[model samples]
Target: MNLVLWIFTGLLATALLVSTVKAFLPREKIAATGPAAEWILDFSPGALRTIAGLEFLAAIGLILPAALDIAPILVPITATCVALLFVGATTVRLRRGERKTAVGDLVYLAIAIFIAIGRFGPWAFTS
Candidate 1:
């Protein structure tokens, strides 16, 4: 279970890092990408950047403490935050009638929630 959690954590963190980079692009550039990126137009550039910054932090938080075995409780806490962020993302997608994209957001949310539960429960590193 621990290994599985680590695998998922790494994958999620990598994905967030990629997303953070993309989010940092110019708003016009992001919005012009394609249908998958159309949602970028809904948010102000600053807000988009802020969201990206949080995701980057979350990615780091998910990995560093656990890997270092120092303040490892942060892994679950960060996972919770990631889940919350996905909840908001899913809400936005739904509100925009982007059901297809919303499903992807839900998948991320589920993964985050699973990590949070595992880390906070029997598979906890802090245990």
Candidate 2:
């Protein structure tokens, strides 16, 4: 379970890092836009950068605590935050009638939830 959570965390963080970095770029700079970008484009660049910053923190938070063996409890806490982040993403997608993108957000939300639960419950690391 720990291994599974680690692998998922690594993948999730990497994917988020890429997407979040892209979010930091000016919308006009992007050659193309996806459904998710539709919602982001509705907001100001500052808003997009804010979301990107949160995502950057989340990506690092998901692994830093556990890897450093310091305040490892933050792993679950950060995972909870990631789950919340995806909930917002999914909600925005649904509001915009982007069902396909919403489905992807749901998958990410599920993975975040799983990591949170696993780390907090049976797979918890004890120092």
Candidate 3:
């Protein structure tokens, strides 16, 4: 369970880091957009910025809430939310016939779901 948590933490942290970096990058026009880019661009830059902020916050929530044992519910909530986002992302990619992107989202979704279940279920950490 600890191993699972660590893996999930690493994955979420990596995602948060990458997305935050991307949010600061120059925005390009949505030309020749792929499935993932198209889906992300459906939301305006402001909305995407908000979502990226939330993702970064959620990444902190996954670790901090549990570690501090304050507002512990946040851990599972973050995991669940990220998992759901990945699910939607995977669905969009699949619908767009983007197998590689769908697979990547599936991997993320699986890790997030595992973290959600582990944190909220029997393996819950208590500090």
Candidate 4:
């Protein structure tokens, strides 16, 4: 279970880091800046960047609070927040008629919820 949590944490952290960097970068220079990127940037660059920053913060929240043994509750809180973010993303994708993207969001949402449940419920940290 610890291994699974670590793996998920690593994946989410890397993804959030990359996304936060990309959000800060100019749209034209963004590596994966495709139609989706343009769409998001067009709608509201500030909002997108805010969300990216939140994700980065959440990523850190998941690990730091528990690893340092200070405010371990932050781990589950972050997990829950990330899960909610994914849910919002899924809803946005669905509303935009992006079925494929919605499916991807569903997967992310599931992982985030799993982490929240594990961290806050049965698999909670003891130390």
lDDT of each: 0.90, 0.86, 0.75, 0.78
**Predicted candidate 3 versus true structure: per-residue lDDT over 1-127, tens digit per residue:** 7776867777786786677654675445442454456566556778778777877887788878777789887877889999888887787788778787688888888889888888888877666
Candidate 1 vs. true structure, TM-score: 0.95
Q: Which lDDT tens digits does candidate 4 get at residues 10-120? A: 787676677777567775555256645444644466777788889889889988888899989888889899889988888777777778667777887888888888888
Give the lDDT ranking, best first. Answer: 1, 2, 4, 3
The per-prediction CA RMSD against the true structure, in angstroms, equals 1.1, 1.5, 2.7, 2.0
Greater TM-score among 1 and 4 belongs to: 1
Query: Where is model 1 poorest over a 10-residue stretch in terms of lDDT?
Result: 21-30
User: Highest lDDT among the candidates is held by which one?
Assistant: 1
My TM-score estimates for the predictions, one after another, are 0.95, 0.93, 0.80, 0.87
- The clash count for each model shown is 0, 0, 0, 0
Model 2: per-residue lDDT, tens digit, 2-118? 899999999889878987865657776652565456676667878888888888998999999999999999989999999999999888888889998788899999999999999
The alpha-carbon lDDT assigned to residue 54 of candidate 1 equals: 96
Question: Which candidate leads in TM-score?
Answer: 1
In candidate 1, stretches whose alpha carbon ends up further than 4 angstroms from where it belongs are: none
Compute the lDDT of residue 56 as modeled in candidate 2: 91
lDDT of 1 by residue, 47-121 (tens): 998999999999999999988888999999999999999999998888888999898889899999999999999
Model 1 Cα shift for residue 4 (angstroms): 0.9
lDDT score, candidate 4, position 41: 45
Q: So what's the TM-score on candidate 4?
A: 0.87
